[model samples]
Target: MIPDMTIGQLTTEASSRWGEIWDPRATRMTILLLCPRKERKMMELHGDMIEHGQPVMAVFHRPRAEAHLLEEQGFDPRAASFQFVNIATADMGPWMQQLVNNEGWLRSSIALNPTPFSVGLPSQRPFEAVQTLCFRHPSLPALEQYFLPYPAESLPGKCFVSLPRRAAAEMARQQAEVLGVGRLEKPQPPAPEPAPEPQPAPVAEAPSESQETEASEAEEPASQTPPEDTAEPPAEEHVSVPLPPTAKPDPAPAQAETPVPLPPTPGEASTESPAEDAPGDGELSGSENIDLPEVVEEAEEISELEVELRAFFQELIDAGVEPSAFMDDPRWEDISERAVAEGLETWPILLQMTAMG
Candidate 1:
């Protein structure tokens, strides 16, 4: 049968087991055991005794661990001498239970009856497990409270610590930042850049001089797009890529047959909702083609009229128009020219006409 040693007897055995020859007065009564995994061996503690005024002890490492033990001056590799008999209660039940329950902790062949107090002995966390189990009360409230902030599985060697969600998110974000822009998805190659637009086949030089004159006038509208609507001018280093030819131009807008005269600023806004007037799912009927050009002309006419209309309305409000004279015989053509020169709209005249009739 294995000899059962009290915490005090372990002190004598620890010293004798090491074969330490010391003066009887110099033999340390207390010591720490330094073991790794299951290995052990011994050495004497003399410095702390001579220097710190503390009682010293004989220490050892498992013989099997002899080759692996460190021989540093102040380091104790084992606890071969310790008189733990004076320690009131030393139960290692909780520690053994914790180790068994926490499978990932270091392999611990727990003592059946803990007559030893190995407080200073080292393990993964020094003596935390042993001390915790020995001192921890068995009451449910005590157990629950003790385990609240830290679960046993979360103990270093224990693998059951589920990572907290916030910590996980932060870790993931940090990893993404480390990966940088290069490793990320490469923008799907941008649909092959659709191949630069075919430049209108350079307009087959017009056959006749008369046709050329018509061509010149037609060419003016192509360049007429407002500067604001086009893409911004490219900076020096970058070349401006013209839109690809694959995409077709938007179709002409539909409108009434006669040119719809511009509405006056003083007039209430047109009730038509822009969306209601927007084309829905299908192509316009063939009959609608006749009104297309007229619609385009009216649009061009509206653009020039917008600024004037706003200005003239302001003018008239300052110096009122004669209500009855507004309908005097004057063609819109003459009104158009003067309005063009003055940058005024037909709005003031329209308002007067409305007031007269």
Candidate 2:
């Protein structure tokens, strides 16, 4: 039977054996607990971590055989209690490792173990995927420690650990879809209202005095009275009478005619002065002064002495190398001067300098 040890004694012995493994400055620890299919045990472990003042993030991996049992228990993957990950066909080690790395290790220590599952035979070895993950982390517990009673029993094949809350939630979402279990529906945002269309302005109507005058003159002839009838004697019996000469009607005074204005032809200017014809602030006009080039532009022109050198500098920046490194180099002055003359060639000098990194 295993002997019980005092808490203080345990701490002392732990410090002596694994002191270097845990950084004292770390305020939190990201713990990976495997095969924690039951909710109660997970809660217990979480409380234990909290008591130690370790900010814990846990991922519970359930086997395919126990999935129905979880569903029957009314297990909600979206619950805030703990994170969930599916492990039916996919390996859990690499997935967990990726999560831990992405979440980062700067603030916490990391620990991996399997629990609450039955142990396999002593000859059994952990999964290679788990071992690989552990090997990459310098602060992780020794592989031999994982072969003990608890981890061996729960995580039989591998010993990879730790997860972030966001990563765990994402994994749970993906696993729900894979298992044919539908996800919870998130409420969608309402669409924006459409803009109102502009209406056309009303047009004004002109007066119709010309039409009214034409209509009145047309009816005047038809409305006139007939002349009275009179009979006269034959020309032989008629007497001729001399009449006084009639004065010619005075000529009507000539009226002046108003002149209609006409649009000017091309190549002719209107009567308006040149000042009036000049463009106002609202009108587009050409700028008189030319702006100087940007600093980068000037630098590029100076560097143009070298062929393909500018492109190399651009590629270096794109590849995440510091631009200042090249600029600050002692060779830059000579190279810049030579580039103006020789145009820096790609082959002999540039390749040699680049390989120095």
Candidate 3:
């Protein structure tokens, strides 16, 4: 009979034994055997099979059921082992159930269905599958939220129980179909060729001073020669007109218009005209000079704001968020509004920056 083991024990043993040989591309199933640590021969036999590239893994685990006991011994209760399998083929359900029932040497075990794109030990399949299932049934309120924080194997029963009858039946049928046949490997599409780097345009060299001088010298003679069509005008005959005498009395009448300057008023010294105290055409007044500094400061503030917004956008990109999706995120609404207020093109501008980079 198989002995009982906690989820933590199974994961700890599976990871320590078969961690290095875990290949998502080829590994179809992982079998954790709850056996004593002294079973070196069985472990060695499985290691040989792994070296030979078999799709099976048999790992020996020392069973510890209590979470507190496991933690006191420095074991992680949340670690999980995942195996990639093609859902279309691979008879996973029956074989795992049989292993659980018949094998006395196999103490405890669990099977995981890894997504096609999963790599290494961490699997996103549970969360992805839950989200997809929720989309198909809108009545389900984001089921992934509950499962994402725990190990995939720890909550499989609860996850299955939470599914509606129709979904559960469909899941069972799919599982049966997957377990009955062997998976055929699909051909991967070829990687795209990288674009070639652009070459710099060639610049034309300026003519040397000697060459310029020679060109001018060559053209000098052509300029100096007169056109064949040019001709001088004939001289005109001159005739003098009789002179008329001028009157001199108008100048005396203009001298009477000049008035004597006003004397200084009481308790006031004589001053120059107000126009003399005003600023010259090229110079600024004190208020105007102050305004120039304010204009400069406003421009500086705008430039600084632009720099900060660009940096914030870049940080989001670095965190693996796409610029096009920024509008969909509520956390970025304030930033988006600010960008609009500042007349920024937002996502399009970030897209251009990303492409350039």
Candidate 4:
């Protein structure tokens, strides 16, 4: 039904209404589908973005060749576990108009936990939760993953996956916990086999005490030794002990339970690159967007400026505004332009952040 709806998706032409998860952001209001890769069908959904009066985007697992396609369309696309991406950003207003007007569109975001359980939906009603869960479109693997053993009870028909942010945090926490537990359970070598053959001096001291008592008792002639020597080695202490206790817990420092890293935003490949501390680790990839210039100190300064400027502009980008509109506004452009003349080059960064079709 949204396929024919307009920006509010609730214009007078719309005869019916579907409930929406209350969100403050005016831009991203639409039903989300969690689905398998079905290019043709999803293109139809993109069509519906215009019809329904919502920006169209998708989350799917696939080859991801469509990344730049969405990127060019001004969508925020993200890669999850090398398989999935949250694609489509330009789903509102003129872009939507062009979609309905001329017709079409395209990609960002954190990784979601890849399991049956969703940590973020506990507060939601079962029906809402089902809709949220079922919103993922049915693909072969996703279908096989969710429906095989068949959680048939969970089908929130027609509802969207408006999973709350806490749910995302919970998902992150749960993922962190599993990874933590796995690292704790990993088999490790017994600690440096204790300076081989070095005598355990403590047991030696216990025997010395026992012998001195015997010697003093030998001097006491018979009385002390008779009652004491008769007592056995503390009944051999048959008390049970769990295996790991007292076994020097693998001397290696516990591997920290790091939550799966969140996916990168535009121009932020750190999440996608190798660990920062990876030794001899210079370049993560040949992507020119991240390449460094030759002059070490000077290039470093430019990189710093670039990073700062990009972040400052991300807010406008996320708002789905055009940089040219901001420039024409008179308030921001002069300051931005003057700053650019000072060698800041902030406008291009702003353009990349905002400019949409």
Task: Tell me the tens digit of each residue's lDDT in model 2 across 1-357.
Answer: 013322223223433433343233543212333222344354334332222221122333333432333344454322312222222112233444543475332222223333223433333333322321222122322222122223222322322222334444466677788787886677998998998998898887775999888889987876775655777765676678999999999999999999989976654555454556577522534453546777764453543444446565656656777655766756567757777566555445455556554
Off by over 4 Å in 2: 1-18, 21-60, 76-157, 161-357
State the lDDT of candidate 3 residue by residue for 1-357, as single tens digits. Answer: 113433334444644534443233442422322223343344334322222322232222222232333345453433422121111114334333433454422232222223333223343434332211111111111111221223333322211001223433455566667786444667999999999999999999999999999999999999999979968798897999888987666554444567789987754543544455555633655556664434444444446556766777677778888767755766577876787887876666677768865
Model 2 residue 110 CA deviation (Å) reads: 23
Predictions ranked by TM-score, top down?
Answer: 4, 1, 3, 2
Q: Where's the lowest-lDDT run of ten residues in candidate 4?
A: 143-152
Candidate 1 worst ten-residue window by lDDT: 140-149
Clashes of each: 17, 8, 4, 20
TM-score of each: 0.16, 0.14, 0.16, 0.16
The lDDT values for all models are 0.34, 0.41, 0.42, 0.39
Ranking by lDDT: 3, 2, 4, 1
lDDT of 4 at 49: 34
Task: Give the per-residue lDDT of model 1 (tens digit) for 19-136.
Answer: 3221234422211222232221111211211222212222221222221222322323242211111111211232234423643223312111211223222332212322222111
CA RMSD for every model? 47.2, 41.0, 45.2, 51.3
| lDDT, residue 269, candidate 1 | 44
How displaced is residue 157 in candidate 4, in Å? 3.1
Q: Once superposed on the true structure, which residue ranges of model 4 sit more than 4 Å away at CA? A: 1-40, 43-91, 94-98, 104-156, 162-190, 198-357
